[model samples]
Each structure stands twice: as C-alpha cells, then as structure tokens.
Target: MTQTSNISRRRRTKQAKGGADYEAKRAELLRIAAELFKEQGFQSTRLLDIAQAAGLDRATVYYYVGSKEELFHETVEGVLDANIAVAQQLIEDDSLRAIERLKKIFVSLMISYEDNYPATFVYIQEQMHQVAADETAWAQDIMKKTRQFDQILIGFIGDAIAQGDLRGDIPVRLVENALFGMLNWTHRWFVPGKGMTGQQVAESFWSIFIGGMVPARADA
Candidate 1:
C-alpha cells in the first residue's frame, strides 16, 4: 500500500477503536451510577459517589451522563430495554408450548432481576415514591413500561386459552397481574444457592399457575 493510504487506514482504525472505548466507558459509568442510585436512592446519590464507583472524576461522570436524574433514566432504560428484548424473543420462539413459554419468561425475568439487583431495587423504590408523591410524569412513564409487560402476558394467556391450555373465564388483565405479582416478587427472597435455580422456581410457579388457570375437561 502507498504511504498515504496506510496512514488513512490506520487513522480510520484508531477512530473506530476510540468510538468503541467511548461506548464502553459510558456503559461502565451507567452501571456504577445505577448501583449507587439503587443503594442510596436516586435523589440521595451524589455524582461523586457514582464517579468514585466508576473510577472517574465527578466531572468525567457528568460529561458522560449529564446529570444524576439523566443517569437514573439511562439506568432504568437499560434494564427495561433488556426486558423488552427477552420478551420479544420469547414471543417469537415457536418450539415451546404456551405454558412452557410462560415458564421460560418467568425464568428469564428472575435471572434479569438477579443480574441487575441494584437497578431493580432502585427502580422499585423510585416507582413507589413517585406514586406516593404524585409525580405524574414519572408515574406515567413507569406505568407505561409496566403495561408493556402486561400486554405481553395478556397475549400469552390469550393464546393458552385458545389452545385449551388455560381457563377462558379469567380476565386477561387479572391473570396478567397475578402472574406478574408471583414472578416479580421472587427478587425479594430468591437466593441463588438455596436449592433453587431460576428454572426451578419457574417450574414451581408453573405448577400453581397452570393447574389453577387451565380449564377443566368438563369446561371444554
């Protein structure tokens, strides 16, 4: 290659690597900020704390995330994004029966909670406070994301009912709410080494949910 061409190629490579490095740093900052926000509450967590956690100066943290509230939003967005992706994948997979698919969804959700405990904790606490304080915008945003999950559950339940695998009399909304209550609350007491993997927990849930919700033969 000519000297000029080689220099240009090296410059392009350097820029590409720099872009990747920036993204990595941004993600690290968001993760650290999320942990701090979860532990201390978003309003109480200082930029300095996030900076210290991320091994960066406060100014650098601000440069990446802009502000504490923005960081919190980014953190929540990251978790929700992961959740949406998982739900989409579950909905798309056709190999499993509806009940089996439901089980996998629960398992994936529990694993997500376990993996992002800090963010989950922070989100829950913030949501409660938002509702209590009548922070309309925040509450609405939270509710919107919640409704997304509810809709996914409703669709699954609807499918199962159509397949004669679930009871049709139960309202989709009610079933969705009950299922979410059971699955989401596992983060409170679920311990990894306590003789139950996420799949095992999901199986137990399936026993109760499927047995109770499935239509009787006489009803068919």
Candidate 2:
C-alpha cells in the first residue's frame, strides 16, 4: 500500500474509536438528564442540575449532549425509537395472530417502561408546550416521532379489527387512544408486587381486558 493509503486507514480507525467514545459519554449524560427531568420536571430541571447529576461542569454537559431542551429531546427520541422498532417487528411477524401480536406489543411496552422509566417518564409526563415555545428544530422533530407512533398504533388496531379480533363497531381512533391511555396511565399509579413482574402485569392486562374485547366462542 502507498504511504498515504496507510495514513488514511489509521485516520479512519481513529475516527471510529472516537465516535464510539462520544456515544458512550452522550448516553451516560442522557441517563442522568432523564432521571433529573423525571424527578424535578422539565421546566424545573436546568443545565446545572443535569451537570451536577452527571458529575460534570455545566459547560462539559453541553459538550456531551447540548442544551437542556436538546438533551431532553434526545432522551425522548431514544425511547420512542426503541418502541417503534418493537412495534415494527410485531407488525411484520406473520406467525402471530393479529390479536396475539397486539398483546405482545403491550407486554413489550410495559417491559420498556420498567427498564427505562425515566425516558418513559419524559414521554408520559412532560408536555411539549415548552419545547414548542422555544421553537427549535429539535423541538419540531418531537411531534413527528410522537405522531409516527400514533400512526403505527392506528395501523395495528386497524389490522386487528380487519381480522375480526377487535370490534368493528368501535372507531379506529378511539381504540388506538384507549390502548395508549391504558398503558401511559399505568406509570402514574401502577406498582409491581413482590411476586409479580412487569411482564406478568402486562399479561394480566391482556388477560382481563382483551378477554372482554374479543368475541367469545360457543365452545365451552
């Protein structure tokens, strides 16, 4: 290889390693920001609070994740991106019945909520009114991702209704909203018991409510 070719290869390797280091630091900052946001709320939590939580100076925190609003936006983005990926998987899987896929999504969402409560807390608890008031480009993307989930959810409900799993009489929008309302409200009051797990709680929701929604068979 030419001398310049060897130089280029080393440069690329260094860049890749640098990128990985950047992401790791950014992720750590995001975690600290999420918890502070959940505990004190978006408006109350400032850059200094996040910097202190992450054990860094205010300027160092910005170097890692940007402004407080931008940091919060990225936090919400991570959770929504994960949830969307799971929903996409269930939507594409042909093995599971439509109703079954729907139930799996519920369980996955609950599991996500348990593991990433701070991120979930941001999505469930914070209103984007402040973000919108700021009018930054990052804030603009927030609504798009949120609406994207709503659209995908509507698709799932429509598929279930089409397969005769959900009642056709109910409006699609209402069904979608109702499912989200059930899941989002749980974060506020639902507590897991000693013997029970988040997955079990999710299953219980499916077992109880889905049982009522799905049509009954004549067979005993």
Candidate 3:
C-alpha cells in the first residue's frame, strides 16, 4: 500500500477505537456524576466538580452528559424506573394475597431506599422543590405516577373488599393515598442496621395499614 493510504487506514482505526473508549468512559463518568449529584444538590453541583469527582477532564464530562440538569434528570429517572420495576414484579406474583402483595411492595420500596439513600434523597428533594416552584406541572406529573400506583393498590384493595377481607366503607383513593403517605415517609427516617430490618419496618407499616387507622375490634 502507498504510505498515504496506510496512514489513512491507521487514522480510521484509531478513530474507531477512540469512539469505543469514549463510550465506555462515558458510562463510568455518568455513574460517578450521579453519585456526586446525589451527594450535592443538582443546583449546587458544578460540571467541573463532577468531572473532578469522576477523575475526568471537564470537557470530557460534557461529552458524556450534555448538562448537569440532564444528568440529574437521568439519574433520578433511572432510580424511579428500577423502583417501578420492583413494584411491578411484586404485584405480578399470583400466589400472594392482596395484603401479602402490599407487604412485599412496602418492604421492597424500603429496601431500595435504604440501599440507595443518596439517590433517593436527591429524587425526593428535586420532586419537592419542583412541586413548590410550579404547582400545576408538578401536580400533573406527580398525579400521573400517583394514579398509576394507586390503580394497582386500588385493584388489590377492591379484591380484598369483595372477598370480605377488608372494610368497604373506605374509598379506594383514600386507601391508596393513605398507604402511599405512610410508605413514602420511610425514606425520611429509615436507617439501615439501626436495630430494625426492612422487613421489620414493613411489618410495622402493615400493622397500621391493615389493622385500620382506628382502634381494633374489642372481641378479638
């Protein structure tokens, strides 16, 4: 081959290899950036800080993520998707009763929060801030997800009520909102290995959710 032709071939090969390397490094950088974003609020975190935390040049960080806001959104969405998947799996189990399924969902959510405290904290903060800043948009988005989960819980509750397993006087929406409030609050106080396991916390929650908000029957 001519010298110029050989040089051209080497250049093409190098570009191809560099493209592959960039993708791999970009994935790693995104992971590190997510951790940093979770540690510091998205507004407080700087691109250079993320790059430094990821051990990459600032410009290279831009190659992986377009902006800090984009990175923050992606990170929060990834965690939310994973959590929805866990809930979907638990609800799909045919053998478990409605109460049992609800227990699984609560336990799994608590475990997820405990395992990913940083990501969960960031998500919660962003969601709260967004809601406070723009009530309309935030309410719509929150209601969309809330309604989706509410449908699942309502279905289970409806089945239990039909089977005489639970009280029928309570509205399904009320039940769903109450349960969501109780379960979602766990992210605030749930510390792992502080003498209570996720399952134990779940059971305590179930006791309140299943046993009714009011006093139990006297004829036990």
Q: TM-scores, in order shown?
A: 0.75, 0.79, 0.70
1 versus 3: better TM-score goes to: 1
Model 1 residue 215 distance off true place after TM-score fit, in angstroms: 2.7
TM-score of model number 2: 0.79
- Residue pairs with colliding backbones in model 2 are none
List candidate 2 segments past 4 Å from native: 1-21, 128-135, 191-196, 216-220
Give me the runs in candidate 3 sitting further than 4 Å from their true place.
Answer: 1-31, 128-146, 192-195, 213-220
Model 1 TM-score?
0.75
Q: How many backbone clashes does candidate 2 have?
A: 0
Error of 3 at 23 (Å): 7.9
Q: Which residue window of length 10 is worst by lDDT in model 3?
A: 131-140
Candidate with the greatest TM-score versus the true structure: 2
Task: Write candidate 2's Cα lDDT for 1-37 as tens digits.
Answer: 5754555565455546778777787788788877888
Clashing pairs in 1: none
Residue 75 of candidate 3: its Cα lDDT?
Answer: 55
lDDT of 3: 0.67
| Tens digit per residue, CA lDDT, model 3, 1-220 | 4754555565455546678676677556666665776677667789899888888776556546657766655555565567677768867788877766766776777777666655566667565557435556535665566457667767777776666667777887787778767767766776667878777777787787877743235596
Ranking by lDDT: 2, 1, 3
Candidate 1 global Cα RMSD:
7.9
Residue 131 local lDDT, model 3: 43
